[model samples]
Target: MHVPDGFINAPVSVAAGVVAAGAVAVSLRGARRELDEATAPLAGLVAAFIFAVQMLNFPVAAGTSGHLLGGALAAILVGPYTGVLCISVVLLMQGILFADGGLTALGVNITVMGVVTVVVAYALFRGLVKVLPRKRGSVTVASFAAALISVPAAACVFTAIYAIGGTTDVPVGKVLTAMVGVHVLIGIGEAVITMLTVGAVVAVRPDLVYGARGLAAPLKLRVGGELVDAPAARPVPVAARSPRAVWATGLVTALVLAGFVSFYASASPDGLEKVAADKGIDKNVEEHAAKDSPLADYGVKDITDARISGGLAGVIGVGVTVVAGTGIFWSVRRRRTTDAAPTHVPESV
Candidate 1:
């Protein structure tokens, strides 16, 4: 959930912000190890896809709705480090450009929504894959479970934060119970989305899915009535899996979802916003810093038609997020190049 400004005290907010910054810094370095010529573009598309799916909020309970968190999906599609970056970028873009999330309390969003989700989901995914049968189906199953748990874990974290810094005088127990209860329903949607998306990518390009790596069972062979396992081999580099086709397909899908499909997204407040309103936590909410922006609230300023305005906003968001994500990933990739230096000369020469 995006914690708006004034929800948390200044000291806690600043502290969370610092933690978010440090997580991003660490992710950038880790991403350098994960990105390459081919998967670099995939990283950007993953961000765009997350942005798109987030627009389509599904009904979770009696008047409560939720959307894909995308941490597990992104971590499975790209690497975990890059997954964290993708969500962070989306959160940042939404806060600054769309006025969806809060700018002042961005750190809480990143910490709870970005880092915590990735860590919890990926860990659960890995744990499941290790014990389950090493098959493609197992990967998908693990993904579903991982995604299911991550949302509630994130909710717990937010509950703790609210306990420490909530502006309202509401009891912490009520907040925690309501937050966890609603988010668990939300987690079901997250799990399904994560499973389907991961299954699709793993089916076509398992090598590109970081979480699926090393999960492939060794090729078994029967030689003269004796069964034996094939020797271990490193997987093909993700760059060899063909990037242009996937990138093109992903871009088209993003365009379709944002430009046309978004018209059908649920017309209800998401889990956090609804809870805040009902629980009196939203009383102190401040106006978004970017409220005056033309593209604020996911609508074009001058576009009269609701469909057209929202469509334009979605398209623009996809384009900007993809460009921004690609640029950040490429920069991280480039930093790994070995520094040029003078060659040593032999003393005899």
Candidate 2:
């Protein structure tokens, strides 16, 4: 959920900002270990995809809706460190460009939606995968469960933050109950979406899925009625076309989802919005700083056609996020490569 300004007092908000900044710094370092040539570009695509899917909010209750928080999906597809960065980029873009989240509450949103969700989901996902059967299906199952839990975990974190710094007088217990209850329902939708997306990627390119790596069992052979490890197979040549094919397909899918399908998303308020209203969390909410931006509220300024305006905004968001994310990831990957390169010692002679 995107926290707006004034919901949390200045002291707590600034503290969260510091925490968020530190987390991002740590993630950047961790991501260097996670990203390589093959996966670096994919990381950017993962962010864009998450941005697109989040636009299609599905109805959770009579008046409440939910969208993909995308922690599990991104972590399963990429890696946790990169996943945190991915969601953070989306939150930043939405806050500054679309005014969907408040600038002052950026840290709160990043902490709850990016750091907490990614950390919790990835931890649970790894645990589940370790105990379950090491099959592709198991990864999907783990993904679903991880996503299901992450939403409520984020809600609990938000509740705790509110307890410390909430501007309203609402009881902390009541706020926690309502936030967790609605988010649980929202978590179901998150689980399904994560399962399907992770399953699809694992099916097409398990190598690209960071969580699925090393899950494949070694080849076995039966010799003299005893099973023994098979000889290592010869490396198969990757067609020059495969990588481009997958990238093209994924980018196209993201474009379609954001540009065409988002128009059909439920218009009702999302889980956090609904809970805030019912629990009085919005009593002190302030207007977004970017509220007057041309692309504010996911619509083009002076655009009368709701469909066209929203579609253009969505498309623009996807493009910008992809470019920004790719630039960040590619630079990280390059730096990692440079660091790993051999350094020559000269002048000893």
Candidate 3:
């Protein structure tokens, strides 16, 4: 959920900012180990896809709706470190461009939504995949559970943050209960979306799915009435194959979802907004600093047609996020290459 400005006090918000910055720094380093020529573009696509799916909020309860938090999906498709970067980039774009999340509370949102979700979900996903059958279906199953748990974990983290720095006088108990209750329902939506997306990719090309990698069992051969491991097959370099088909398909899907399908998404408030309004958590809510921006609230300033304005904004958001994310990831990939290159020393003449 997007935490708006004034929900948390200045001191704690600043503290969270420091924590967020440190986590991002760590992730940047870790991502170097994860990204490559192929997966780097995939990571950028994951960010744009997350941004698009978030616009299609599905009804969760009477008046509450839920959207994909995307940590599990991203972590499964890419890697956890890159997944954190993916969600963080989406939140950054939404905050500065769409004026959706709060600028002041950016750290809080990143900590709860980006860091907490990725850590909890990826850890659980790894554990489950180890115990379950090492098959493609098992990865998808583990993804479901990981996604299901991550949402509530994030809710608990937000509750704790609010207890420490909430501006209102509301009881912490009520806030926790409401946040957990609604988010639990919301988690189902997250799980399904994560499951389907991961399954689809795993089905098409298991090589592309980070979590599904190495799941292919070694070939076996029967010789002299005994079974033994077959000779290792020559592996193809990741850089040799083209990822253009998958990348183009994913981009087109994101474009369609944002530009056409989002119009039918539920208009009701999301899980966090509903809980906040019900629990008086928004009593001290402040207006967004970018509220007057032309693209504020996911609509163009001069475009009067609701459909056209929202579609254009969504398209623009997808484009910008893809470009920014790709730039960042490609740079990281290049850095990885630079770090991995062997240095030469001249012999004494």
Candidate number of the best lDDT: 3
Global lDDT for candidate 1?
0.88
lDDT of 3 by residue, 279-333 (tens): 8999999999999989999898999999999999999999999999999999999
RMSD of 3: 1.0
Residues 186-215, candidate 1, lDDT per residue (tens digit)?
Answer: 999999999988888888877778888888
Q: Give the number of colliding residue pairs in candidate 3.
A: 0
C-alpha RMSD values across all candidates: 2.2, 1.2, 1.0
lDDT of each: 0.88, 0.91, 0.93
Over 4 Å off, model 2: 237-242
C-alpha displacement of 122 in model 1, angstroms? 0.4
Query: How high a TM-score does candidate 2 get?
Result: 0.98
Q: How would you encode candidate 2's per-residue C-alpha lDDT over 206-313 as one tens digit per residue?
A: 878899998988889999999999998776565642456667788899999998899999999998899899888899999889999999988889999999999999
**Native-to-model Cα distance after best TM-score fit, residue 294 in candidate 1, in Å:** 1.1
State the lDDT at 63 in candidate 1.
81
Provide the lowest-lDDT 10-residue window in model 1. 335-344
Number of backbone collisions per candidate: 0, 0, 0
